[model samples]
Target: MQPTEGERRTRLTIGVVAARSGRLAKLGDPLTFVTEHLRRRLRHVVGQGGRYELELVSRDSRSDPEVARRVTEELIRHERADIIVTLAGTRVLPAVADVCEALATPCVTSAFPWQVHYFGRGATRTRPFSWTYHFCWGLDDIAAVFAEMWAVLGAERRVGCLWNDGPQGNWSRHRERGFLPAAAARGHFLVDPGGYREPATAFDDHITAFRDADVEIITSAATGADLARFRHQAARRGLRPRLITCSRWLAYPVDGTGADDPAEAKVASLVYWTPRHPYRSSFDGMPAADLAAAYERATGRQWLQPLGLAHALFEVAVHALATADDPTQARAVAAAIGRTRLETVAGPLDWTTGPVPNVATVRLAGGQWKRGTRHPHELAVVSNSHCPGLRLEADLEFLH
Candidate 1:
């Protein structure tokens, strides 16, 4: 099946891997959804005069780290990937960071907070040497949003925090350091009931303790179906505390159904970058209706927050590559990203990082479930700082 002598081929291979456990179904699952969206976007970009080849390698990391490392190595060394994009958290980041560093290639990771420092720190130190970019929010930003939510609810005096016990969870631990003391100084009590792993079948046990402690609010670092189950179980048992959740939670469907829930429904979420409602914005220029239509036509599904974020990331990446003299060079791409200021669906993004007087730039906004709508209750700008680094603390209490 080889082509004749004069046939020319220009191939640019990019590798993508997901660290989350299990195989992907066509719809519903977060990893699958993200991966498919990325694939579609990549194809569209390529079709629009961008020549590149993209391949996705799915791996199961639940069993062993060495297995994940081996998969990464194969992609880089054997597959000869020009760039490696990982949708894994700490599990894969630490394993591949050194390899990418040694090889002097770019590694773009879509990880939560705990892994941010691993990638961010790596990116900062190895800049122009080995390029690393994190496409997720920061932990400090999460903490700040929690503080603001508690303050807004007038529950600043006492707060409780709950997180999973993994790489993402570890980032929550670091965030508490900055968040708890800030709350305490504001005459609030900070409570950490350790960390709980996902598939939390022991709902009764956790709720009992929070109830006993008279915890007014409970903030969680969990997301997707886990958050829905947590809320449903708590509500059924009458353990409704004021609820605050991480940005990941915000991406879930508001009603626990595909459509939006009623406005009276209660499920508070913290997010980075303001959510694009069906409204107008001068910065992006793309009207809400136009963006929604474009997204629906492109993906064959209604647009949501996560889709918006993914689209924005893809747009930025395309822009960076399009304007580069050598699009395949990792260093050139990184430099382009850092220097270019582009408008995206997620609003304006300045990729450059540096210490400034006002490091607490607003990153996380808040949202709630609307009882009966396709979108979550219109997202609101709560805190003016990034939610990832903020010590997030809030409780979900149902009002019956």
Candidate 2:
């Protein structure tokens, strides 16, 4: 005999692809915390006059593109995941997005800029994606926020750049629409060393050029390892600038940086989300500060920005599941994701109003790492020109 209307139940599976072990492992730290928090919250979601049971299965990408694709395929084919979620950078996120798009599975992600996800995936205005949707700030937002921070510091107009030849670097070095144009609008000159491939061991040539040009402000979006190598080499050559700002660096607790390192003091990056963000989670109405404090207390580690981004990723996923009348249908879930417009811990996300059909932009502020009274090091909001409502916590400090 068929079950009664009140007894009817639907099971929804969510597959997660993250950089759990490898160079980018730091980016995956929040997944465990956020998923544990959601286990109870998502035990049963009431919608469509019936109850839905949710299960989450996670796979580590190991920070490799090939591994990301393989695990995503397994989740879709073997695990029968109704939806997929990933939080990573251009390298691994794009790999997962490609698999979802080809397999016609729905996916949501953040952490990297929208430009890298949209353009790097060969998506154009005429040819848009249907299965993958992303939410994050763009390169232009980073340019505006970084320029504002530099101006506040009264730094010299000459700025040295060290962008790698990745998707982020290629777009950031674009003359007409990249970071330079926005900085130039603020009367700052970028001394670009041009793009170079990763695994580049030495930067003697770039250092000499910057020293010759008397560049006092340095900026880049290189990977954490590459950035560390460049900084070490630059220091040996006595090329320390008054300010060093590296995008995508402040988002995670990478080795030799973040809360435990005093040597990283005064290094700056663009801020995506923070405990101070004036927003609350749609899941349990938990404020951003409370969520961050809980993570710190539970893990016995400093709160990183990915905690908020990762939590908000689930917020969107659960919202999509709840809104879809038929949670088992991929089309229904994808439609709900496309129509998502809810307030989350990372701030409000509206897919209908993004610059592109598959992307939603987030607000950004300029921040610097400083010695903290609470933690070994803490990220301080130094400029909020792009995010006027985010309170400025401190003035931009010079490394000199």
Candidate 3:
């Protein structure tokens, strides 16, 4: 609703919490980029009408849940924020989401799967609270992309679960969660040894068990440091799997400089928002490739995967605000968010027709790190089972 001539401008505050600094520095400051890009968009939007303008309040989670929760409370209580958003993996997002639920505040979150929050909190079939909305690839997408990539590989199906204590790792090892069920649906079985913690000096026991089990494939969702450590240990332990498809580890650039073994050549990963996918931004009609290019040009660092998903959060917020009759009313804004079905930079997000209430997912595709003909190294899109029409650039190659 447009304000009358005498009506005052409504100030919309968006509180964004993320791991802006700390050990997670290598991952890049995703939320900061999202907030900056959103500020540009919101400025153009508010220029259209002086009725409402955005004021984004950002907080650094320091990659800590306690900090995330504290910042969330500060946003709801002190900042009097009309809406809140968070960006990170399972560690920070769920805690902030919990605070939003407690305060009955409308919040949007991303960078982690809905299954992580759902099953981690012991949510059953019944819909729980309804204040927060989450969107990201669930384990189902990971399993699908992995399974499809395996099929294309045409190798032995013996799968080894290289699980850490992370959300994706924890779920993949649990029978009741999305990973195994999705794998079963895809006609695959997993060889799970057990869960391991990160920063371990050795993976001898884990590798020995997988080798004994005759596992040809290894999949994991561990931290980059852990995976790198594991990679070094696997080389030393003589654990060679035909296919090694992992997430998180391959998400960022590791200073390879001669550290990588030849086995690392054909590593496959779950690529959620590759520029090859035909997705367009709601802000400026820029496609994924163009948006990624702009990000890299603006910042010398590589564009992160979370950047696209981060943008989706703002898309949800803007949609909710525009759709609400009175955006100032938190409940009205929350209700509007619940009804969002917009085509965002990530893809088409329809929260209303959800597989789970208050959750929407953009499909994923498989990608492989291959020796680049153009560049030194590149991740080529390989499987498009989940995201159809996404062009594949290379065939799946055996890593070991």
Best of the candidates, TM-score: 2
What's the TM-score of each model vs. the native?
0.67, 0.92, 0.91
Predicted candidate 3 versus true structure: per-residue lDDT over 1-400, tens digit per residue? 4457877656777888867887654443766776886676685224223457677888887878898899889988888777888776557778888899889999988767678876676565585557888887788778878888777656337788878766667877667666877776667768887778765667777888887887778888876566677777876778767777886655554445354632254678877886666888877788888777777877776666777887788878877877776777788888888888899888999988877878888788888876655345667788876787788787888753
Off by over 4 Å in 2: 1-9, 153-156, 253-265
Q: What is the number of backbone collisions in each predicted candidate, taken in the order shown?
A: 47, 0, 0
Enumerate residue pairs that collide in model 3: none
Total backbone clashes of candidate 3, pairs 3 or more residues apart or in separate chains: 0
On residues 171-278, what C-alpha lDDT tens digit does candidate 2 reach at each position?
887776577787787888888877778877998888998999999888888766777788788888999888878896777654455522523535788787888899
lDDT-sorted candidate list, best first: 2, 3, 1
lDDT of 1 by residue, 317-392 (tens): 5665666556656677656655645555555555555222101122445555444345434444434444333232
In model 3, state the lDDT of residue 274: 68
- The parts of candidate 3 lying over 4 Å away from their true place are 1-9, 26-28, 44-50, 259-263, 373-376
Q: Which ten residues in a row have the lowest lDDT in candidate 2?
A: 254-263
